[model samples]
Target: MPERRPTRSLPETLRTLRALRTPADPGFWRSPVRGARFTAVLGVVLLVGLTLLFVTGLLSYAAYNPDLNPVNDKTPGKGWLGFYLFSWPTGPHWLYRLTQGLHVTVGIVLVPVLLAKLWSVIPRLFALPPARSVGHALERLSLLLLIGGALFQFVTGLLNIQLDYLFPGSFYTLHFYGAWVFLAGFVTHTVLKTPQAVRVLRQGIPRGEGGTRRGESGTPRGESGPPRRGTDTLAAPDPLPATLSRRGALAMVGAGSLLLLITSAGRSFDGPLRRIALLTPRGGTDPGPGPNAFQVNKTASAVRITPADTGENWRLTVRGPAGELRFSRAELLAMEQHSAELPIACVEGWSTSDQRWRGVRLADLAALAGYPDRPPGVFVESLQRGGSFRKAALRDNQVRDGRSLLALEVNGAPLSPDHGYPARIIVPAAPGVLNTKWVETLTFGEL
Candidate 1:
């Protein structure tokens, strides 16, 4: 502006701007370990790992029975994302436990591998001529989505595991929408790159050299010395002397995965094994010793549940087509008592081993509510004054299951105050929140 230089046309100005930002020099990247083979290996691992993560993640959402809407569904206006959702089954008892445990534990274990994979292909991110053609432009866009999506999903999932919610808006909605966006890019990238990756893995670099041969100008070359060009930006033309071999790098990544697995997998188990899950939130916690001693997501005090709130005056209200009825703690205990050994699994992926839970059957309560046979869906309410799941709705199958109970005791002892002293709903294969601790009311009907 001070010099009053000659004005340039829009095309010329755009070209000049592009040149200013372009990293056109091939010698810029100096990593010998960055190559087709290394990236391909890491890509294959993510292919399998990410597919499992996605499937299990969807299953976790479905297990919530979001069809109940407003009560269980956190992500409103999900549209097509809700297509795969179905009625969660109430069998095998440990279905949610196994699936969610794998989801979190595997995600933790893959962190190192994912990082290494990103590192291996970092050169591509800064490749000059951002888009050479229409197809290339689309490919670049997909790559951006893939990288960004991967980071967002992993970061949010880890924060969730740690019980941190620093991100704005509901975690459920953000994560669900983010997953779809990521999946779109992921599927596109996978389709386009799978063939090339497979070919590279099977064929190896030309002349079986683990590293690429560079020409004088720091450009990669094939056997005949032609400038090897295309989408393989990972080939660093002027690689530095290798400090770590490719195989050694892969071994290091695998070792990291193993360490994470060792430290995070134990959160799903009971007894001594649970102590080893130091990387997880509830891993190191000591709930003290007793029949009731086990992991708890929240204490009674944390939920603002006081002893006075669950005092003898507390009455469980049951409502149905016939009418309404009420019962005291003694009356519920006197009713035909049922017992079941079921594990309470949380969405965060922590769970307890099967504990002896004794209580009145939910179906029996439905009988007292008038729908004696084939109990319809029941909307259970908790005494908790405030929380996300103060009330939850159970599907008809869950209500009809003989194993489902309005639990009164645990491990042959009365439930502790923090463990829903007066009463709690305990259903097989149900999320821990649906167990509805400190239960106060049961409304039986179509929900």
Candidate 2:
């Protein structure tokens, strides 16, 4: 017998298999526009999640006090969340930590998404519709502001991580103010887009004879075919004379662009940058660490000065109502020394680890300065001089806050000059603005 011929009908076989496949099919799903939008939206959501976490975490972290946790007793088992939700459980430390972690993780995801989304949507930017007069200009202005702010965040955030060497202080100032600008644009975009979004959803997708095109090519409701490649082909022009009617494919694009701007504004910064200036490099003039970075002064600072060659001599001067008290580096080192672990939280919303610091208590040092029972103020000067002074008003409450220390050592090592050598004040929960460094003068009474 002749070899039995394979009797499979290839077209029929393929058709049968395709018929078995659904949009819900588990395998090799494909849709380009929807996929890109989905990715874009995902990026927005992650960004938003990060923002929520950071803001919430910061509020919680500021309020948290680890001392409250009951160390002696064994509490019933629950993970960190349960601890945060129930008992004293270390206040919001765990919550802040978890959210901060999420914020960072999402930030990492955003790098690629930021590039992809911008590449995908940038063509649409230059193709914006023409506006009429000042009102139109304002609307466009709002959109521009939104776009600019978004771009600022994305760019600064990335730069912060990679290029700390180039721009050190830039991150400190711009990152703070840019957040507000972004928020304003976001709110405006959402307000403007709300009605259009509702209209689009209400009308739903249009279909007709011969797999007819709907709103636009490659859109969810506009057109559908094998997913278009790089650029989805534009739909055929409307047969109806162009009226000002918003019931067309162009309206959909407008709504989407609006939505993108709104969503991005509201949530894009939610990730790591929000928590710790994500793109910002670590370990600079004021690099953020947490409570663990604390330690006591160990070096015999005949005078503890760093960068030891700036033509600046180390000096310690104490002036107050009781009278001017001055000390050479030798005099400060002669004073009684003590050590404690403390936390230093900065206003930029980052902190040193549980830092073990050794130094004289500010209270003790104040007494040495012969302060009144309640001296009015203190001033710390850096060795570099030229109008660098941290003037602190020493109220009764500050005097009593035992956590305040004239730190001479950090993390079990003598203070590095970058960290304010010789001595600096470590005040828990105070911002970097308040944590005085290179203490050359302590002036009490009015400032």
Candidate 3:
């Protein structure tokens, strides 16, 4: 005979399960008094460090764009700490790229810390009634602006990186403009917080007891009742509830672990390493044979160069304002030689490995073309007849810029027909529009 086992009703089992699955509410984190100083110090250090990067980044951008800063192109390099600077126009330079990567990388660490700090201090938001006084209103307004700006920057920047859907130029312009706003708000917040924070530190303000009173009483009152007992009396409102604390702690651990992984990942997957390792070449990998692919040695009339076709015999002719014209492959090669390994930074916001360049310096070519005595602008035309000329009016400010080069080779090899063949202008740090390929003629301008 089989023995029968006892079974509970379905409703009882459901009730038991529901009781076991009940969740606890998560509150704020109330750090010990000593923790305030540590957190404050850490935050201040990070804030200062990041601010310096912003200042330096502005300087770098200004330096790179000599038209913006006509007098001097030499700005102090961001140096070892350059990683924090994340402004744009990042071209084929080691230091600039290094700084940009650092800015994004360290920001990952600061994100959570800032969030946690805000969480801990949120109770202060309700400490006073809104718009009670002018000073109070201003204080609250400033805090709102400061937090809003910070959140705006952090959120937008992350989104810009992850999602490719930002309205073109919006991110860059905002990033550029918002930087100053952030700086102003940040400075104001620091100045406002300094006194209270310093006072709290100096006095060793007791837990939840010190600081200015909310509303005061007129006269002294008699004892109300006996003080409450046990840890429960002094216990906080469980700033972080058990469930949230466990979850947050777990999350923090996970993030920290991820950060460690990212650090290693960055080492391999960032900068030169990641660019070289993970990213596979796209679209046109093999550009085909050199400038000789389409021979033009026999053609007397200059065949019109068009963007539609990158054929051989693609002769890049140069003409000056005063009707001075020059042609032939021998003349360009006879000029001075300059080379650099720079990345092609597209406005579409993606970058490639450092491209090796070999060509005559535009300045030198300009000098040879009768501009050495004085500075003058030049017009660059592509072989394609219908397309517009890539004209760059080099002013006195940009005359000495090293970034301007007429590249004749890529990766130590002669330029391919598809890649502007015989000679192409390689503007080192300039945007895509400025790096004129399939160059057919150079015309000097008085303006």
Candidate 4:
């Protein structure tokens, strides 16, 4: 500065800045396990697990019937993203439960593998001469998206499961969009690197080559050579003594995944097995010792639904082409009563075991609304004062299902206030939210 040294150009300044960083020197990353073979094993596992996670996540969105718009659809301006969406089916009664459960459980289990995969290739992130060409620049950009998207998805998903709504905006919208972005980067990276990864896997880790010896740049002992390039970037230029072998590292990651699986999978089941899912939210708890004892996502108080609101004054409104008919809780109970054991599964990946639900069939209600033969879509509205899913629109398949009910009692007991006392909607294979509690109105129409 004293001599007014010539100002360096932007590119030159960036190069110098990169040179000073510890990561810029391959020797700074002294882990012997950071190599192509190690990375390939982790990558293959992620490729399979992440693919399943994505499909199941998309299926969960579809289960919400997002195409209904302003009703259950949270993501606005989805455009072509909704192209592949189909009318969510209403069969097997546990479809949504299984899909959403897999989505969440697999995502949680893959965390350790994802971390290991990143660790094996982190040196590539700080390679000198950041962009060797336009193609290289594109590669780096994709990598950035891949890492960022993955972290964002996992963090948001975990927060949702914990019922922590710290993030601004709707979780459904954010998660839906984030999934697409992650998929793009994932597809690109997979295409670009699959061949190399396959080749590395085919040729397993070399024997007796645990790591680059200390003070060596991946060259044979007694020889001084230039640092490695390309795929060899993961090889430390000047490594430290090996503390853990590559196979040992892989085994550790597998064990971690297995542990998470054991602790999370039980949330989808009932009885004694469910007690083992210590890591899952709402797991291992005895809600109470009674006929209606089970999980409840939101109590009447939590949703600002007061006792008076669901008292004798409350009436179920059924509207359609025929006419508008209203019924009191007693009137609904007087009508033909049906019973179905359906599990209530939530998007947060929690599910209650099948509970005995007794109520009038939705199809019967639709008939009162004039659509007796083929029940049109029904928009079920809740009496809750606040919260999303106050209203939800069910597709024709769901409404026509014999098991769909406007439930009056659960487990042979009149519903408690927290369990949607006056009335609630319970449909097989539908998400818990769609089973609108404290149901106020049912409008049958084309939509």
Which candidate number has the best TM-score? 1
Candidate 3 local lDDT, 1-447, one digit each (tens)? 999886889998997776562112112324332134433544564466557546644644442342422221222332433334332342435444344444454444456656755654454564434455676677678777677777766776666645454644556556655666676778777775555455445664322321333322311111111223211111134443244443454367458635533442232122444423222211122223443222111111234544344434445565553456665556667767788776554322234446678887777766666676554656666654443223433333334456567887777777765456667776655544446666767765554
- lDDT of candidate 3 at residue 446, scale 0 to 100: 52
Clashing pairs in 4: none
For all candidates in order, the CA lDDT equals 0.84, 0.46, 0.49, 0.84
Give the poorly placed runs of model 4, Cα more than 4 Å off.
1-21, 205-231
Best first by TM-score, ranked: 1, 4, 3, 2
TM-score of each model, paired residue for residue: 0.89, 0.51, 0.59, 0.89
Evaluated at residue 73, the lDDT of candidate 4 is 86
Worst 10 residues of 3 by lDDT: 218-227
How would you encode candidate 1's per-residue C-alpha lDDT over 1-447 as one tens digit per residue? 388777999999998876563345556777788888998999999999988888888998888899984799898699888998889999989889889888888889899999999998776666656666687778788887888998899999889878889877787887888888889999988876776577679976533222344222222233212243333456677689999898988999999999988887888877888888777777855488897898786778888998888998999999999798999999999999999999878888888889899999999999989998999999989888877888899999999999999999999999987788899988888888888899988999989
In model 4, how large is the Cα lDDT of residue 419? 84
Least well predicted 10-residue stretch by lDDT in candidate 2: 65-74
Residue pairs with colliding backbones in model 3 are: 27-239, 28-239, 82-99, 83-99, 294-312, 305-383, 305-384, 306-383, 306-384, 317-440
TM-score for predicted model 1 compared with the true structure: 0.89
lDDT of 4 by residue, 307-351 (tens): 789887999999999889999999999999999999989888878
